[model samples]
Target: MLKKLCLALALLVMPLPFVATAHAQGQSLNDILEPVRKEVGLPALAAAVIKDGRIIASGAVGTRVLGRDIPVTIDDRFHIGSDTKAMTATLAGMLVDEGKLRWDSTIGEVLGADLPGIDPTFAKITLEQLLSHTSGIPTDTKAIYEQYVDGKAYEETLSQSRLRMLRAFGKNPLKVDPNPTFHYANLGYVAAGAMIEKVAGETWEELIRRRLFDPLELKTAGLGPQATRGKFDAPVGHDVDDKGKITPRPWGPGADVPAGLGPAGVAHMSILDFARWAGWNAGEGKRGPALVKPETLKRIHRQHVTMTLENPPPGTPKSGGYGLGWGIAASPWSDNRPVLGHNGSNTMNLATIMVDPQRDIGIVVTTNFPGPKADEALQSLVRTLYQRFAK
Candidate 1:
């Protein structure tokens, strides 16, 4: 395994811009990625760098799963957690653009009788507030399982009850005042999904597929359980032990889907498909129809709410700031350049998406191991890669 990793790293460093047009424009895509492959214990990883509307470099390393010899490919799908939030936010922006919804429109208007005890303050909560994390909704743990726990009859019941519980709790009022301070709330996105359904007359899944994925030609991007069961080069989630042995386990999609929270997380895709998204965000390429006009995309990236340096989740790096659905962090190795993206982790998966618009470069790193060092490794890799390729 070490030998294969080393060889892959060596190839990543070689200068082949002429023959390997993928590495053109002085970009050493792989040279900086070696540490990520070595430190994360990832069985497989793939990344693509886009520059000036073209795929300048793209490659994959390692195996698709531990103990299997299958090589990872750019097309191999992987779970992309909170990165899904940006897509959800984009969908909301599109609706706003269509005059179907307003950024300052109240959630009570969208949810109506479904959310019975909603505080009057919630009536002032806007679609933009939810997208920007200013809605002040509690990040409900039970609500998460209620929406995503997959199964049959009982699962559905639990889901509805959780939604009801959330509504009941809302009568007390938001933990923080609405529409100002930045509070990262997954449930807020769930509410946004519900709003999309109420106004569009379709489920969140259907709206996302029609509005974002289909147009982008992101064939591999979709909801979890269904996509995992389908025939595709999908990477399996794994738990890595202290000694680095990968152990396979079952972590079926949770109940976030039924709770109308699929917007915050639950989307899955391959590096290639995700690269297309990064490309679009970086103004490098076009997908299908513009999901939102370029102006809308700019609005999505703007810092809508301020988060104190002290507010990041307990273990998150001190350098990062909450921005809309994504996190903004200063690139330590690039004279503190700003990098925009999101990092996602659950019990079975770890993922990061780092995009530098100034350089028109993006990197995504994912691992099945939910280990202590996974996030640190990913952050380090992002800085290392930027130093290597960005002038």
Candidate 2:
């Protein structure tokens, strides 16, 4: 009887064919992300991949605070920077859907007496042109930041002052004819946000919360650090100085939030919350409650204008194209896979969010540090993740 029991135990201990199968199927998402993790010096990263309106995989790596060793969770929030533009564009599309505005309506028609020194030519600029950044208006955020926003409250006086500056300089002809060619300008989105306020009769933040965030149940997503303060964990922002040491910057609210520039940059969110946003875009207006109609999202994703490498504009790589508020890049891992997404950078942080709509796959990465090579590292990590999942 003992010999017979021993023989049965040996048989049970022997590996079954399904063991290898299960091992292969259960390979961790971290397996693919680890390489990029080491290369990028990302102290913390939270990411999720969606497929068919479901979160197939989600995880976090490294630390939320560098020296604290507080591990990052999927809900850790980060400054998404220009990805805010996508949210702003969605809001604009919703306004269009609600009949509050038209794509062809001129900026002057909406802004009316608020903007001074009105150029008649610019008065004819359409909402579509502003959304696509063909309004011929230069991005004045840098100058505005240096001159007015450093430590002061952005009041109506400063807003009017900037408008005067824009009117004075906006007389130059457009770099490319509107609607058929792309030229990214942050001022265009700033103008779009202003239009939202003017037409909706509410502050931009209140309108966004009522029309966009509340409807989608994105309780934690907002235009500035104060919105999420004490409600979620946030990462510190950093930049490498000339001496190559990582220096920390004061983490505070972004001035662009209240200045009607929410459409260009200045959004705050967590990876999990942003994943829900990606799911909505990837699913084509099917995920969560519908903020904008399917037709509106389709218009947002359509390649309304072509971007050329020879004359790449601000806030974009020479190799990428602009579509509405998002960036379009050719996917390296698939045959003719055109990925739609955006990359964002501020003084102390860098971020990228990409989605392959056909495959229903998306990646969201945020880092606290900024350097010359950070964007390149982000692009490379995106490529690596695509290769891993594509196979």
Off by over 4 Å in 1: 1-35, 140-168, 176-179, 225-227, 230-232, 240-247, 250-260, 284-288, 309-315
Per residue, candidate 2 scores C-alpha lDDT tens digits across 31-113 of 44445566777666555555566665555576655566667655567767778777878888888998999989877898767
Clashes of each: 9, 0
Global Cα lDDT for candidate 1: 0.61
Q: Which window of ten consecutive residues has the lowest lDDT sum in model 2?
A: 2-11
Q: Clashing residue pairs in candidate 1, if any? A: 22-56, 22-57, 147-255, 147-256, 148-254, 148-255, 148-256, 149-254, 149-255
In model 2, how large is the Cα lDDT of residue 384? 54
Per-prediction TM-score, please?
0.80, 0.80
